[model samples]
Target: MTEALEIRNLHVAIEDNEILKGVDLVVKQGEIHALMGPNGTGKSTLAKALLGHPDYEITAGEILFKGENIIEMDVDERARLGMFLAFQYPVAIPGVSVANFLRTAINAHRKAADPEDKGISIPDFRTLLKAKMDLLEMDHQFAGRYLNEGFSGGEKKRAEILQLATLEPAIAILDETDSGLDIDALRIVADGVNSLAGPDLGVLIITHYQRILNYIKPDFVHIMLDGRVAESGGPDLAEHLEEHGYNWLREKQSKATAG
Candidate 1:
């Protein structure tokens, strides 16, 4: 079966306020698409809704994964179905070690895929975890630390990317992964993402700035404005946004609305 994520005429609302006004998009495996826009344009809302966040209500629309409607699927169910979201701010789990959390998650996926097979053995799990950590350039000791607890901003983001690496999802949505990172940290995290980009993975990178694109070049660039995609083009479109900002797009959207 062809692996793809398709969003058709998605409309999302938080509380009584509608955020995403009719949005449509499709992401296939082995592709990277960057959704860029100013704050409050519902970039994050679209990402959250796609992942089935309870707070964001999907007033109308459909989210299809592998040609199946997944709007009703629970978050864990989506994760188990090879969908991942790397949050902008990773939450701290005070007691759970990174290794423990990943092992449990991996086992859950394994068991879901096959009912009879037992979860990965401890030694084997450790080896697999270590290999993934190394692929992300993370130290072996990093797994011993509690998941995101007391981790620096960089560490938290890197840990999120590590989870992405280990899970190897078919579609990964990065919600502002570059939100809070220094130059070095940004490069590190971007490099980690770059390393994981391949035929098996399709990534949706949501960001406000074009800086992150410099490292993980997107195959298509989309500009979101007022809860809808205003314009979309190749990498050059991002460079245009970098130089002119979103004012032009906002004006264009306004004119179109008036017309």
Candidate 2:
């Protein structure tokens, strides 16, 4: 399997305190990889670093997106390179309609794909937007609403997926996309992700619960401990983590150190 994202000994820090110590993760094309862990274990930090968040600094190591070093790339540059990150908390932008935001994003994507004067026309844009919205079961009225303003948690997540569908990114980092969602919303989001899954798209779903795994099974499950990925395996690993919790891992680590 060809690699979509490759991280080599990634060391990240925030305010001089290291959060990710020599972590490595790789996602191949068309694969769903889940990064599961307890709260505050650097899962979110890793996602932030991948998206080039300003506060998180990469103290060492390299992030290769399709063999290109992306650590130094700015957030917009990363997005332009077909990398999308759906935030855990979708921010609200008043006075910006969903329609306008989506159209602008789509235009940006088109511009990145073709740097020439060519771009997706307005009519073609609307058609594509409508088609994706329909796939996500989003209301036509949603187009007129301010971007995520007054939206429920479920609505925000659906909107995120809607953007994902429209952007068709090569690598999608869904950061805790399932948090605060009910069963119905979870199903809808999962369905949206599954429908869009293919050889061209690789997903890294950062989640804490196993419920979402039922809807979209990951090809690989990685457990992030204190500052690094401690374990990795297939889908069954998620089930194990759900049942036994992280205590066993803590115990094992302690014993290994003592011995």
Candidate 3:
């Protein structure tokens, strides 16, 4: 069977400045992989590139989803193919209600899959949205409010996870979901992710801190540095990073460069 997402020797640049230098990764269904790195190390760049963000140009390498190269696909095309990205900083749409936004997205996906379909009915959409909101422990009022408008940090993060739950993407890339969140908020977000993790979904969590891993244990841990993935290992690698920090990885990279 084809893998969920396979990135081979991926290279990305923005405005002629290369950010991701030959990144190779494979995420299979039912696995969670954490890409941990320091600030400005191209972690977020990698996430954006995978989602086909126009700003980050993919100068080289291939991104294959389910055995087909998606490097040339557009952002909406990729999303329609069951790939979802939860942004590090989610933008607010002042006039769009959360319920309407979700319904439109869900209907788009449905239409893409079956061109003959008329889209989800209002009654069915409400039931589905309510169930997803309950699963995420969000209030019904959240659905009626404008998307991410005037939401607190915790609320924003929760809203992102709610999108993930509602979309049910095959591969979900959460870029720094733990950023700007407190302990309680972090746990809630983690719980939301944990609930959705199963045989049908794969997750790529890009983060700089190991605190989130304490709740959402990853099956594999990777460390990116200087625009490349320097090391990869099991969950213990995250524990090591938590205890020591990135100094060891930096020293190792320095020696490799000097050699």
lDDT of each: 0.93, 0.92, 0.94
lDDT measured at residue 191 in model 1 versus the true structure, 0 to 100: 94
Task: Write out the backbone clash pairs for model 3.
Answer: none
TM-score of each: 0.98, 0.97, 0.98
User: lDDT for model 2, on a 0 to 1 scale?
Assistant: 0.92
lDDT, candidate 1, equals 0.93
**Could you give candidate 2's per-residue lDDT for residues 1-259 as a string of tens digits?**
4557899999999999999999999987799999999999999999999999999999999999977999989999899888899999999999999888888887787787777847678788788888988998888888889988999999999999998998888899999999999999999999999999999899999998888999998999999999889999999999999989999988888898799
Model 1 per-residue lDDT tens digits across residues 146-233: 9999999999999999999998899999999998899899999999999999998999999998899999999999999889888989
Supply the TM-score for candidate 3.
0.98
lDDT of 3: 0.94
Q: Model 1, stretches more than 4 Å misplaced? A: none
Point out the higher-scoring one by TM-score: 1 or 2: 1
Q: Which ten residues in a row have the lowest lDDT in candidate 1?
A: 1-10
